[model samples]
Target: MHKRSFILTCLSVVVIAAMLSGCAGTMVTPTQQNFKAPVVTLDSMEVAHAFGYWYFSKKVKPTKGKPDNVGAPLDLAFIFNIENPNEYAVKMENLKFTVAFEEFDLNTVASTDTMWIPAGKTNQVRVHAHFDVRQSLLSLLVTGGFQLKAKGTNAWAQLEKWWTGIPEYAVPVHVKAGAAVFKADGLTQVTTFKATFP
Candidate 1:
């Protein structure tokens, strides 16, 4: 009787252990789907000359004790003509902008921003950037490229849940230019542009 009771207890333990293992193996977890951004090619670039201007306000100062005089503000603009050059339309969830002194990369740069783009379109992007006389005054400046990325979604969310599960895209900027100057601070930049289908 003792032997039979011991065997029964051992079998029960084995059964319970197997059941627990099975349940653990069947547990599910959420995961992000793999996504790829469309390939973009640069067709051409256009940049205007930077004009020098100054402004003084109640909060700021001017040169030679000038009484709070205001002058035209320094403005810089660039237009990029990009080509999709792809057969299929690419969905850009987020865009990344970066400024480089000589070479274009995430590191060894100044600032970065994110935006979005549509598919099969040649967009004309405008970047309003300001530069100041800091660091080395004689640093040679070149063009930079924006990095682009694509988001993945298995299903579309409804109006209330639309904000959920929407992935962002990243893109690179490639411009053809060299050597420029900007202000040290108080600079406002703008990039309002689009790409059209080629």
Candidate 2:
């Protein structure tokens, strides 16, 4: 009887070890080929703060040998939602997009802020864009001049309309040529997007 009991104990140990080995095999790590690109959407856009919306300074006094400058500042904040559909978490490495007022591309905004989105979950990111009247005027003249002329309007008039209309949601704002980089399990993906804001 003692010999029989010894044999049963050995068999039980072997069975337990086999079960553990099988469980370990089931716990496989996700590989690069298993990665999927995260979905990105424009959650909202806000005129966070705007001062001197209609105010323009010209021929300002020089300070510390700096040349005279003109400035009227506007700040906008864009919020986005990143959704990870994979079974593993994803890290957003960077995001960038062009800001367009109506049909004119005014500036390119970017964020290097990194965040990890959990598996089958979502995360939010906010990026800010700043615009100056003087720089915007130059951009319009150099890049969008022909587009403006075709529309039968001048640069200053268009700038004024944007400055006054954006805060009131009367003019449409666009996010164009957007690219966001995400990484997970040694895999990298670039996602592109375009959105319009009211």
Candidate 3:
């Protein structure tokens, strides 16, 4: 009888220790996090051409100076930031995007579905934009910017810049977005990226 009780007691302790160890390695619930903005590189600007759209063809090589063509699509690519704080998965939805340079702004970009951001990481969202040359160029020109002329560009491109007012080369740019995130408690967290660029 004495031996049986001792064995039973030992077994109980072992079981308890085993259970505790197992629980220590268990996963925790995830929570919601805020989105972070990434630094954008705007130093090198080029006007590349696509046959039909921004990805259609390499019809024109990347040229510097000023962009003045009323033809082809314009390609602009940049990397931005998104941050998730919780261990739980956050579902990103309802993204509103704006791409602006100085006083020029475009509010036409939209996303239909949600983007998944895993827990505890700042995800870099690299955006490659395809803009209509006619609209984009005309926008800058009409907003008081002069045609920028790069040395290697052809004369037609040089003469073609539609901006007629006194040229302002220095412009500030902004890429902002309003994002909504689904959190752990079935709650919605909304955040905005609000910064202007050099």
Candidate 4:
């Protein structure tokens, strides 16, 4: 009787072990074969910080001074949601995008920050871009001078509108030609996106 009881216990253990092994064999792993493309979307954009427009000039051009410039610094933050549908964690290597105010392209910004998005989960990335009034005016003149004239508006008018309205969420800001690089298990994917903000 004792021998029979020991044999039954051993058999039960063997059966459980076999079942666990089979389940393990069928379980999915995060590998190149099972990787899925991740999705990126602009969640939100806001004026992080801004100093209203200002200009300064020295009437007496004292030979030792910087050029007369009218400019203010504006900081904008963009938040993006990255969704990973694969069974493995993916790393975002970099992200780049061009910023447009109204219909004019203002500047191109890039973030080299690395982030890991978990499998079957969503992660948020916040990128900040700084724009100077003087620099932005230069860019506008170079890129959109003709367009601005066609619209019957000059750089100052547009810049003033953007500077004041952006803080109040009153202007339309656009994210264009966006590209993000993601990697998982030796596989890489580049995703492109574009969005507009109110």
Candidate 5:
């Protein structure tokens, strides 16, 4: 009888330990996931002339002065209008992107958002980009289209973790656009515009 009771108690303890381990495996934490911006339309405005002849005379035949190297850095801005078109609010983070110019890899850019838009709501986001004109003009003159690529964090996984009560890092963004040459001379040039997110 004593031997039998001892064996029964050991078995019970083993069963209880197994059950606790199973419960711990099921435990999860809740944390919000990253938001990904949909591929929206990218529209470009008219390409305005960056330089114009200022002073010149037809008097005694005079040789043209040095090329108007005023604007050396070109500024290009593109606006994207995004529509929420979804049911859930997207948390913006963990996004990565790259830009290609004239078939050459240039650089990667980062993005920032000032506000968040609720579901079925429309908002505006802005992206500002600048590049060296001397390096870009050759490409622009050859190819009219500038390549752009972007990527964002996975929202669903983040949502699942959040719902499960797990802590997660904030999402990040990646942006990139082809560069263009400037007509004038300048060290730094900037392009600023706004994108409407619906």
Candidate 6:
């Protein structure tokens, strides 16, 4: 009986340890992650609005420094759609993202926020990426493609990935983004395309 109890106790300990590690982000970044696992994928991202004398209807020039107000500086708010295809609820906290304009070497960090992605549904996260507006029409002439990179982690998100049998983690997923197509007057050229998901 003592031997049987000892065996049972050892098994219990091992099972508990396994459960704890599974709930924790041991293999999830701060370690390793499966990027291509597709726990969550970027469904779509759009430049919903253009603020400043450029994209706005008003001809008033945006201010330079206190640019949150239109005519102060040129700013753009992008709408992002993130989808959780898994049945497990995955959450991301204090996620960081960057929209990089490699052609112009301009890059901006997105706003800080937490994203709670529900299972099998799409979550919308809006990021306002800002750039200092020059007095010239330079930004209006920006053309070509850019890259959007985002990284976020929650133990739940990681657990969900592993639950789906993905052993690796994919941090900072990269998506091919077209640059803000614009005309000479700062008017954004309206074009529709799709954002690819991994």
> Which has the greatest TM-score?
2
Candidate order, TM-score descending: 2, 4, 3, 6, 5, 1
Candidate 3 Cα RMSD (Å): 10.4
**What tens digits encode model 4's per-residue C-alpha lDDT throughout 17-52?**
999999879766666566777898999997999898
Alpha carbon lDDT of residue 39, candidate 2?
88
**lDDT for model 2:** 0.87
Span of ten consecutive residues with least summed lDDT in model 4:
54-63
Error of 6 at 115 (Å): 2.4
Write one digit per residue (lDDT tens) for candidate 6, span 70-119. Answer: 22243435555555544444554433344433222344443446555555
Q: Give the lDDT of residue 97 in candidate 3.
A: 59
Q: lDDT tens string, model 3, 1-198?
A: 999999999999999999998886685544334333222222322223234322222344446544434455445554556667666456666455576643446444545456667767665555455665456645555643443332344323422331211122234445655343444446577665545544
Q: Which 10 successive residues of model 6 have the least lDDT summed? A: 182-191
Runs of candidate 3 exceeding 4 Å displacement: 1-72, 137-171, 180-185
List TM-score per model, in order: 0.29, 0.81, 0.47, 0.80, 0.34, 0.36
Q: State the local distance difference test value for candidate 5.
A: 0.37
Q: After superposition, how far is residue 152 of candidate 1 from its true place, in Å?
A: 49
Number of clashing pairs per prediction, in order: 32, 0, 6, 0, 29, 15
Model 4 ranges with Cα > 4 A deviation: 1-33, 57-70
Q: Kindly list the per-residue Cα lDDT of model 2 for residues 1-198, writing each as its tens digit.
A: 999999999999999999999987865456767777888899999998876554334455555565544656889999999998887778899999999998899999999988899989999999999998889988999989889999999998998899888889889999999999998766798889889997
Off by over 4 Å in 6: 1-72, 134-198
Clashes of 5: 29
Candidate lDDT values, in order: 0.33, 0.87, 0.49, 0.87, 0.37, 0.39
The 10 consecutive residues of candidate 1 with the worst lDDT sum are 159-168
Off by over 4 Å in 1: 1-36, 43-45, 52-76, 81-91, 103-119, 135-198
Worst lDDT window (10 residues) for model 3? Answer: 160-169
Tens digits of per-residue lDDT, candidate 5, 1-198, equal: 999999999999999999999987774322222222333444532112222112222343446555442323423344544444334443333122344432343335556543344555654444544544434434443443333122232322222322222111122212344221111111222233222211
